[model samples]
Target chain A: MASITLDTVGKIYPGGTRAVGDVSIDIADGEFIVLVGPSGCGKSTLLRMIAGLESISEGTVRIGDRVVNDVEPADRDIAMVFQNYALYPHMSVRDNLAYGLKNRRTPRAEIDRRVAEAAVILQIGPYLDRKPRALSGGQRQRVAMGRAIVREPAAFLFDEPLSNLDAKLRVTMRLEIKELQRRLRTTSIYVTHDQLEAMTLADRLVVLNAGRIEQIGTPLEVYRKPASTFVAGFIGSPAMNLISRRAVPHLPVAAQAGTIGIRPEDLSVAPDGPIEMEVLAVEELGAQRLVHGQTGGERLTVAMPSDAPLSDRLRLSYRLGSLHLFHPETGRRID
Target chain B: MIENRPGLTLLAHLVLMAGVAIVALPVWVAFVASTHTATDFMSGTIPVWPGPHLVENYARMLDAGVSTSGTPPVGTMMLNSLVMALLIACGKIAISITSAFAIVYFRFPLRQLAFWCIFITLMLPVEVRIVPTFQVVADLGLLNSYAGLSIPLIASATATFLFRQVFLTIPDELTEAARIDGAGPMKFFRDILLPLSRTNIAALFVILFIYGWNQYLWPLLITTSSDYYTVVAGIKRMADAVDGLPQWHLVMATAMLAMLPPVAVVIGMQRLFVKGLVETEK
Candidate 1:
């Protein structure tokens, strides 16, 4: 296991288009760092650069104290699990696991031992001789993970590895990945566009926007105290509501603050409250209901109990000290 | 086809049977004629049934060839044709697959230009460039040799382009995965790309084998000695006999023998050929 450090990393394509710029993060040994953002946010590109699949355009990537800016992917001692799994279609699960070791000229007994161990760990021993095409998606996924595990590399890079699975399988695989990482304790950098996946899997979350780091902190820390309006809006489902200060002039916020942020759960129905919201629509999500409405010409959504009372118009009160303030011009959080 | 109409199915079967008969008639006639002596054709109407001379006529062609034309035995010509076909098919596949690999995977100056140059050769077949090609072969002292017969036809743009298409359909992720697995280019080619394209190679081999086997003009042009004669070219030479009428019985037997190998190749790899042509599931 090893720590990875990206120092002011940047990526500029040959066509003069910048994919990622001025990004840096320190990932501790055995810690899981998830780079999460929307599509085109360079999350995958950043992971690929660290994996040495793509060349770093600028800055140095240090893995276990060695700068790997020009290292080949094989020499970099990093294993990657791609979104598509990338298993060799022609190879059986056993051979697939052994291929990297075989290429490195690992001894026959040692390679066999490692491959067998990985198969046991992945519970794929039963399917060792079966080709990848014979396996189901989840089985193939395990084989892909087995390919990485047998390498015993310094770090593991995952690029949305669970995105191909169905929702239930994704949850199953997500838990399995977390458990596997915990057991192995390898330094891992995972990239995904799913905020929930990032939140559940990350030791520290690096939320990105437009190819730049929006904020980097533990999941709860970033969720509770978003450093920017983008983070506040993106890190949570039924995303934190950010409205213009003018939209809610009645709220007790600093006059200098230009925008107000409130988590959907922070708002409660109150008979006599400051903000009057006109009910628009309600989404039924079994245990909880999302109430989307307009208050003072700005859109706001509230997460309420499914049993909560509702009406055409209702007064809403936010918990004290729950308000998040930001600059309207820059959208940066105001402490 | 999906509707399962009985009447339409009957019509389809009738048309298909008609087509089969139309194509198989000449081959049937050739097979029947091979069983007869030269006097059988002299009587006028062609023999529709086998004659007692089948074994005698075939044995003569296989052992002594066409005595009048001074060609080698049918067995020798068949062996020569086998060598030439194997060389051309194997050589073409080897060169084209590697060129396609280089074209698809590597980055270098004039890579596109190199590919286009190979692609343009498809328009200039051996027939079009026969004079210059033959001159180059003669200058290199390859005439009347197996190298002369096969090497000139080895550089196939069709096979190269076909391989390029096959390689392109392979997902890019496989390449990235192989790189991460520490496989160099040739290792990746051998272990991954080659195995994945197994069916395609089989399909192309069948095609190129038949193509090489049926070659008449190129083999006829370069090989003047009877020792280097391919069966297909030798048949034409036997027919254009300088002395009397060509020995029809021996000639027919040679044609039958020449047709066997290609037909056998097709039959042997039919399943793989169909799979390669239709499905690229990987």
Candidate 2:
């Protein structure tokens, strides 16, 4: 319901440990922004700061033009779905969804109406009287989502909410959450360490590393044109392969000493090509085969169609446009 | 599975039987002594089985002039002990739960320092601070009163520490969910924290109740008059009244009477206590 603006936000703990530094982001009303990073990369800490669960050591957090740096979490008009689901173990699902409204002195009829509506949306009507312990992992996650939705807050914050579910459930709940957010049109900020979730769900992905923002762009933009070596290495599955430029030909002489990055899928197993590799391992993942190999003392991985026949003495070729060049010393992109 | 290893199973049963006997020995002795005359008990001539002198012993213990000092009826002493224990138990749990919730859930300055300071009280044995604590109570005009007995001993660091540990096991998501739903700290604690902490409260109730019931030094030091004397202190008076010979049967019966409430509480809540301890670690 409200846009969130984080201005130069930073979190420095008492011992001078910087958890987040000089980060600024503007999320438009109804937009879904994801903060993605590895563990200890401060994505969850950033989300918690926005929720007012953590203090912003410097800069300001504004929700709908009002600075909320000093406001309490309950007064911030935001609901958060935590990674653990965090449902009240003792209360039935109905009570869990209605707890906040009851605390705010919402009318009994209104609370009941909202709880029923949320239960229906979550497809959890039958389990309304059951405690969280009785629900499956996915159902518990939905109830956590329902608890947030029933509040009708100004925004929704999610901190790795789907990470606890199994792979299949994670995918199902991921789409369910996206659809829920679309229908509700509440501004949301989601944090996760999973690149696939970020790539699939985010309107704009904010990649973070070591308490700093690495890049912020549409998932495909970040995937196709990563601004730095860190983004290149961090955004892709099985991670983008990086090798010394000296090992690969067709590069400008000045770029020969730097690092070259290539997506596994961008490499092809050619009958005769510029690079020769010894196949170290082959992983068949249904439609695609991931060939793990070595070329010129550098490890490389290439993804080819499952139909493509490969051997130990396979030769691979990569397109020039698909290559990402980075300065080895600075780890920054070079043209 | 249990029947697969007979030798190991027999050893387990032997250990369990030893535990049961060790636990039951005092209760059995107290019951047998309560059923006999003091002369038969002291002479060690009473039968190991039940006796016909139960009613006589009960009458003697309950009589107003049972002791030469004319101590109040034994029943009154028992009632006083029960009342004090209940009050202290409830009071300690209430304070501990609230304090634990505050320390765990709320963001206030000096929160960690406050928690550690409160927790350090567990290390300060009651014997070390008895004189100063009694002086403070006297200054507050709570001497020889139930308020003195309940209030001073009720600020339990152990209970607060235990509750805080229990509270930490609760997923912050639940509290966050409650907050986003618009519940403030008090509402969150009352509706969410308290309900989830049932097992902990039950466990702490048994612990604090026993501590209050078995209290001797504090009550003995605080209350000079027999009117305010608790069961333990009154038992000591009974011991002195018998010219230091101490009627073993009456003393044992009084001890057994004092043990009943806590034993009942423990037996009733043992399941929760075990579960609570296990969950607290998670």
Candidate 3:
């Protein structure tokens, strides 16, 4: 129920390696913020810093009004759900939910009431007496969630909590986490490398690259307008086709811009289109087919309807004003 | 290995039976010898069959013991042995687990150096450093005491390394989750680590109890008094009478008593021992 503010936070290892640097993000109260990146992008490290698990090498982390830079994780009053669920294997679901509360010296009756409430909320009532190992993967995940919510802490920190579940289960749990966050209205920070999970779950997405903040906006906002070349390719699936300006030399805009980015969905087949493509391969994805091909010595992928007619060579045109331009020397966006 | 040939199965059973006989024969002989009178052994033919004086010989050893060797009663020696075994087993587990926890979880100055120091002690058993160990125990005035019998044997590098491997397999997420759950280091150890290690502790307990029970030389060297003599050491003393032939029947009875507790421990913890060795939950 508290807002979190990270002011130029950084993590520098004792051996002089930098994991995360100058990362500043402000999350509104009860907001679901996902730190999204590829592996080794420092999203997990930033989340750990916020959770007080990792020491903050610089900058201030304020949860609510208190500065928690020097505070121990236990004293920071936050609960974390780890990537593997991290349930105490020997404890029953009931005990796992009650552990944090009991550690905080919550009254016995209160602990029971909270555990029961969480069990019913998560539909884990039947599993109250079973050890974690006896439960299925989804059930263990729910118990991990139960452990966090029962604490009634200031915030919830999730380090890719749904990553360990199977793909189908990940979708279901992703929805459940969103629904749970909405119901409880607890400020949560989730870290993940799966862009799809990040897009579906986050109220706002924080895109990180190479230990620095690349972009921060609502999922659609970041998707529609990426601040840099990294986010342009990372945020969308069939990743936004990025090609060098020379690949489309006929276009007058190519003379000024070094890189041109166009999303897959924005491209359509037209007889009067400006760019000519040679068909390389096509991927059938149920309702939609991905047409991968070469155009002017550049690889391109286009998302088209499944029933669309195909040819060996086709002219492709992008939707109006959908083009993204980036600087040649630096990959930053150009207005 | 999975073949169901009857001839191979029969051969396997025969080999297993022969192996069991090779191991169990001496134990059977000891039991049969304990049932007979001293006069039977003096006849120069050791009896394979049980004698009629089984209860009488056992009761004499339990009550009066072998008086010629000046050792305590077999009952008293058994009690001392049980105390020493329990102390050593429990103490080793406690110290090893905590040290392993420190080695695995905490980051401190020269932490690896500290672990290597503990690891290197594996090369130095009490047998290797007996003189200095004995001197330390003597200077601390722990000789002829239960502490002297168990303390030198309690610092087990094998048990510490065993626990270190167990702790290493536990995910770092568990530790972080426990920390965020408001548990301090000691609280996490008690609530999470201790319970997760239950089967391993049971397994180690079985092994260390037998080790403590079978210690003959250290206990023999340290305790000059009969009150502190463990059953294993006492049995050796009972066999080493200078004046006359050893009391064969009574000595055999004491040997039988000495083997009981370790056998019970192994039998009781066999399931846990197998689980600890073969399976890990996390």
lDDT of 2 by residue, B1-282 (tens): 447788988999999999999999878887888887777777856557756777767776666525664467778787778888988999999988889878887789999899889978987767889989989999998887889888888888888888888888777766666766677777777777787788778877888888888898988888876777788778787778645566767777777777777778889989997787676422
- Which stretches of candidate 3 lie above 4 Å from their native place? none
Cα RMSD to the true fold for all candidates: 1.0, 3.3, 1.5
Give the CAPRI class of candidate 2. medium
The residue pairs that clash in candidate 2, if any, are: A100-B181
Candidate 2 segments whose C-alpha is farther than 4 A from its true place: A251-257, A327-335, B1-30, B36-44, B63-69, B99-124, B129-143, B242-256
lDDT of 2 at B81: 86
Model 1 segments beyond 4 Å from truth?
Answer: none
Question: How well is each residue in B129-238 modelled by candidate 3, as lDDT tens digits?
Answer: 99999999999999999999999999989999999999998988888888888899999999999988888999999999999999989999999989999999999999
In model 2, what is the error at residue A86, expressed in angstroms? 1.8
- Top of the candidates by lDDT: 1
Error of 1 at B179 (Å): 1.1
lDDT by residue (A137-247, candidate 2, tens digit) is 999999999989989999999999998999999999999999998999999999999999999999999999999999999999999988888899999887899988877
Docking class of 1: high
Q: Candidate 2, after superposition: displacement of residue B194 in Å?
A: 2.5
How are the candidates ranked when ordered by DockQ, highest leading?
1, 3, 2
Sorted by lDDT, highest first, which candidate order results?
Answer: 1, 3, 2
Model 1, B1-282: lDDT tens digits are 386889999999999999999999989899999999998976889989989999999999888887779789999999999999999999999999999999999998999899999989999999999999999999999999999999999998999999999999998888999999999999999999999899999999999999999899999999888999999999999999797887787889999999999999999999999988887788
